[model samples]
Target: MNKNIITLEYRISKLLRYGVMLAGALMFVGWMSMLDFTQNPLLAFHDYREVTFVHSIGYAWRDKVWGLLTAYAGLILLISLPLSRVLMTAILFWRQKERLLSGIAFFVFAALIISFSLGIEL
Candidate 1:
């Protein structure tokens, strides 16, 4: 095979892999948010009364914490999401390097999933 052909093959393979990763990340987020967190407002009371994490935060700090979480969650998704795709494209040029992009994508994906599942809309 020619040198140019091999390079093209590697670039294509890298792009395909990156696309798969990004799709997986998005699907994972969507799956997590499929719950009925918003279907009942009473669930908030339950969370406050029952969930240990919610109880630990306490009602006083709930709004503030929720605000921060919402802001960051939206920001992360808006930023990391497009960045993930762009970085994957960049990976082609960078030669299949998935370290940094994968980590950022994972974090952003998790944040998006949690925020969506908890009915935190922005």
Candidate 2:
């Protein structure tokens, strides 16, 4: 394998691993806090209801709800991991001068961004 490809793969693996770890940690804290307050996470779920993560984040910020904010931030990061991977792959393909692959990656990235922005479930 090419050195560049190996390096890219290593970087991507690290990104995924760390991203998941961080998200899990954030969720753990969030759930712990919820449990502390309501004595049950599920029972308190409705207290932080929102139409979307974006809205939840805004509400959390305004209300200074640390638990809700951490949870939503983690969710947003988790949800965006695939998009980040696609973007990184696109950049790699571009650097490697693989125009077709790069273009396809870019197209997929754009599609994901559009669907995510429009709140389209797939």
Candidate 3:
């Protein structure tokens, strides 16, 4: 019975981890689409300029798209972050066999929770 409980918890934790990663990916993609990185660095800018072929393409789409990408990106990140933590906690509870993974997941989830809660966007 005790083993079964642990297994159940472990499975929940795994699901949570997967959820957080998915949320993070979605948020990252959304957050990235917001900026005209071709023109300005929203986050980091040094004397060095950041340029990408992708930004060039995005530039063309920018006027036509009418900020849809930025809107969607913001929405997804805002929604996914909290959801990610919930999922992470669930996964942590579910995965017991893999101690290393569980530990890593816990730390990652914890950090994500703190960072996201603080609204520290990359």
Candidate 4:
């Protein structure tokens, strides 16, 4: 492998690791908050699943549901990590003059975006 590719791989590895750690930390804080809020060691599925993303964010800010907000933020971060990797792959392939690989990477990225958008309801 090229030195540049090796370096890019290292950077991508770090990005994934740090992203997961940050998300895990946020989730841990959210879990602890939930425990406090509910005064129970175990949580029910309905506790966190009752609101949509927009509503959870609003509740997090306006209704002081910090746990829900933090948890959702963590989930969003987790979901975006793979997308970020795809984006980085495309950029690196372009920089290395690998046109075909770059094009494929871009195609995959576009497909992911389209699928995600399609999954959302109006």
Candidate 5:
């Protein structure tokens, strides 16, 4: 039982580490590619505008802006990591019959969902 728990924890940690690494790599690639793009960085900064997420995604796609797309993907993955981790933990705890821990994990997962879904930007 002890060894099993250790192995499960190791696996979970490994998953999280790999997820971070992947997200970092993607962001790095996107940033590097953005540097190589034709736009002048200073000019882009001067023309800064706020756009909704859906509009940004559509523009990135329509304009064939691979770097922006890659960067956005990485950002999304990085942002979602914690939520995924919590959900995974909840599932694993439930599977292991850890009633209290599982309940806590599930409650946390729900809270995260609610926060993201219904959270107000102040």
Candidate 6:
């Protein structure tokens, strides 16, 4: 493997690990916040039963639920990490003059974008 490829691999691994840890931390904060108000950990589950991916962020923001907002932010970050990796791969492939791999990486990135957009309900 090229040195650049090895470095990219290490960076991508770190990105994934940090993304997961951040998401988990945000969720834990949200859970703890709910516990503060409800006095029971299980009660926190009820608050999010009706939450949906598209609306939760806005709702959390509007409601001023710091925990929920942070949790949603973490989720968004988690989702974007892979997209970032795909983008990085494309860039690295392009720099390496590997046109075919670069094109494929770009195609995958585009597909991910389209799928994410389609998932949102109007």
Winning model by lDDT? 4
Worst ten in a row by lDDT for model 5? 113-122
Query: Which stretch of 10 consecutive residues in model 3 shows the poorest summed lDDT?
Result: 65-74
Which residue pairs clash in candidate 4?
A: none
Q: Which parts of model 4 are misplaced by more than 4 Å?
A: 37-50
The C-alpha stretches of model 1 lying farther than 4 A from their native spots are 37-122
Q: Which ten residues in a row have the lowest lDDT in candidate 6?
A: 34-43
- Tell me the TM-score of each prediction against the true structure: 0.31, 0.82, 0.36, 0.82, 0.84, 0.78
Tens-place lDDT per residue, model 6, 1-122, is 78878987898899889888998788777766645644655665675466566587677778898877776667778788889989989998899999999999999999999999999763
Task: Count clashing pairs, candidate 3.
Answer: 20
Best of the two (1, 3) by TM-score: 3
Q: Alpha carbon lDDT of residue 21, candidate 5?
A: 91
Name model 3 segments beyond 4 Å from true.
43-122
C-alpha lDDT values of all predictions = 0.53, 0.83, 0.60, 0.85, 0.84, 0.81
State the displacement of the C-alpha of residue 16, model 4, in Å, after optimal TM-score superposition.
Answer: 0.6
Tell me, by TM-score, which candidate is best: 5
Candidate 6 Cα lDDT to native: 0.81
For model 2, residues 59-99, the per-residue Cα lDDT tens digits are 77898889877776787789888899999999999998999
Please write out the lDDT profile of model 5 over residues 51-92, one tens digit for every residue.
Answer: 877788899999998988998899878878999889888888
Cα deviation of 61, candidate 1, in Å:
33
* Model 1, CA-based lDDT: 0.53
Q: Model 1: per-residue lDDT, tens digit, 1-122?
A: 55864777687677667655665665555445434566773565575444443453464265554543443344445445454554444554445455676566566656655765676322
